[model samples]
Target: MSTAPVFAGPDAAVPRHVAIIMDGNGRWAKRRLLPRAAGHRAGVEAVRRVTRAARALGIEALTLYAFSSENWRRPAEEIGDLMGLLRLFIRSDLAEFQRENVRLRILGDYRRFPTDVVTLIDDALARTAANTGPSLAIALNYGAQAELTRAARRLAERLPPEQIDEAAIEGELETRELPPLDLLIRTSGEHRLSNFLLWQAAYAELLFVDTLWPDFGADELSAAVADFGQRQRRFGGL
Candidate 1:
């Protein structure tokens, strides 16, 4: 539960993997006396900027927590706007992903989304599947607890309790395919994960940047990476 001490750097030595818990959109909008949807829309730009930054720097992977299962509790209009933005981003970014040589992969449950969004994401994933560059993984309709529960359920169905262990369960989780997460960023000064990538971020160096998601551009991200580069990742031992 302890966070790594804040470390500073010049951004040349960057971490290979960066995962983000995009927060503070609603608060950002509220402070402006605008609807929460406005902040959400602006956050999309931050996503693009951060992705571009990662790709330009030749980072191996960038995972974004775009939406969570708990988001369903929000009012209907906000939810609709969020879904609309998701579809639009997929459709529009399909070309950008290919042009930038970024591999796009949508993480989390696809079944819960509207049919149009589902198709758009499917097409986008297939279209950019050939790219072998920076991997942009977006988590939508995701909940870390839900992910763990699903993994546990799947494992439980295949093996008796006696046969399953930590390694086996980790393998069954969705984030298992990626290398161990190196850096985890959460915007808006929020200090907790809020059910983002529970299992994958076991050893990740956590960075809680104060910038709101919509305004978090490359410099802010670079600053966080600089901070991440200075910590001693002891994992579970000395």
Candidate 2:
């Protein structure tokens, strides 16, 4: 692996932490005349591919928006399919993750899932807890607004208003365990945050790509990272 700084610097070639909104699985399925479930399955494959690519590229952390809190509003059947897919992914990939030294982390309140799903997630988290490789954070049942609200409540309960500053609130966030977000990518040509990492993205570079989640792979990821390298990030300065 390349020995490069994960944090922002004048010569940083790869982001230390990268977050992705894996969007358009359903649309990809519709375009192919396949069930949305199939698209999601393919999306899982993409996840595997991208995880390996990120690790190979020397990224320290990768965050994926797998499922949102609002996803509960989706149809029950679709939700069930997604849940099943999650179980399958964890069961099939846990060993590989361990072998690759990937640390699995959940960014949202995953306990709200079905008992079995929750059990599987907890098992995965524990099993990979000791790994020192790249961190992979899956955002299941996550929402940026909700995260911020919960962080605020936690701070309010522990500290007075005067002491509740940015650092305190960020320390309360789930992402505090992960690296500072350096690059955020949204796929399927969408150009929105979609309630993800609002606080951590304060100075992170944003990239929108037309590739659907399932179609995303190493090449696309490398291209995006290359594009990111070419841009001059002033971080709101001249």
Candidate 3:
């Protein structure tokens, strides 16, 4: 709902890529004495809100940490709920994504999911493959350490040690095509990366907010972008 441009000032620089670690869904449900599924449902709404806000704010790419590889340790019922939510989101939002020209991209090896889920995800990806609009990347069953290890292994398999450099390793990673990550945000007062985008965030402006994921909305996202615009980023040169 915010009409303010993300780069409000003359000198404000818009971040090319923004990554978020959406946190506190269980906490939010616990606070309300409701089921965790209720909180995750609310969090999905927040995702929709933030996705629209990011595009309106002129962000080229937005990456959301939807599910981590470690999340498989949770109870089967909770995992089932999450998978159901994923199916619901894709079914409900695929049309909106096409209408808004938003490209959907998955950052992890999502093929290992259930057959139906993988089919749905593949269909979405193929449908949006040609779109030129802002990218919305979801990290499901993702782990930065695992991603890095995979990249390294790929490089070692295809290239000689002399050719295995930073760029080569990066090219093998999932986000190789996205712009350099300029900003990373974590909500729910958390202060850790929790295995999210560790390599891409090497120089990103990290912001930790107290608002829970279910409660985060367009206004909070806009405020974070505005705050990021005010900082000086020298990328280790200043």
Candidate 4:
């Protein structure tokens, strides 16, 4: 919504949890007459920039919608490029994340990933599991509806009917371990969630920006945070 560049001090209103729908990589590449892989690569750089900015901004958790379950429908080569980027990012950033105390976690059905990727993901998690810094959760093969269904199944298999309440379901959700979501942003001017964190965004303030994912940087992130600071969150109350 608001694209104004606003900055707030540490004492100002800041969201503890933030999520982003990194969109328009293909479009970004197409605009420049480049291969889609180039845009995906640039998007990875954007991810790095935003992650560091979020840490500096005192955000406790940052969830990035990297690969949705529906993303599998895209061309096989594009998927491979994305997976390659994921591997490179983890291998390249693991030590840096440990040094910065940035804990890493996966927010999706990682079981579907290849054995090598799953191993790397596990390694990254193991390395950063005890860090005491802002957490970065990458959503791979994730969809909120699928997550809800999986949680429901888990609850049904493990709990009695009487115990299946909101609290129980919330506990089963993957995002239960992270801070409650406060701000959600979508890039590329898209206004819809596209199967992102549906349940977790119950009271989150939404902001849509026209910048493509490859071009979004820390400044854009700060602008969104500033916009969030300017708004009042009633959470169903006046």
CA lDDT, candidate 3, residue 149: 96
lDDT of 4 at 10: 41
| lDDT of each residue in 1-238, candidate 4, tens digit only | 1122233334457888899999999999999999999999999999999999999889999999999999999999999999899999999989999999999989888879888999999999998999998889999999999999999999999999998998788888888888878899999998999999898887788999999999998899999999888787766766
Model 3's TM-score against the true structure? 0.95
TM-score of each: 0.91, 0.94, 0.95, 0.93
Error of 1 at 165 (Å): 2.8
**Candidate 1 clashing pairs?**
none
The backbone clash count of each candidate, in order, is: 0, 0, 0, 0
Error of 4 at 130 (Å): 1.0
- Across 1-238, the per-residue lDDT of candidate 3 in tens digits comes to 0111232243676788899999999999999999999999999999999999999999999999999999999999999999999999999999999998989999888887899999999999999999999999999999999999998887888888998877787788899888878899999998999999998888778999999999998899999998988887765653
Please provide, for model 2 over 1-238, each residue's C-alpha lDDT reduced to its tens digit, 9 standing for 90 to 100: 1122334444557878899999999999999999999999999999999999998899999999999999999999999999999999999999999999999999999999999999999999999999998999999999999999998998899889999887788788998888888899999999999999999988889999999999999999988888777777766666
- Which tens-of-lDDT digit does each residue in 124-237 have in candidate 1? 888888898788889989898989998899998999999998888878877665656789999898799998888877777888878899989888877777777667766665
Worst 10 residues of 2 by lDDT: 1-10
lDDT by candidate, in order shown? 0.83, 0.90, 0.90, 0.90
Q: What TM-score would you give candidate 2 relative to the actual structure?
A: 0.94
Clashes of 4: 0
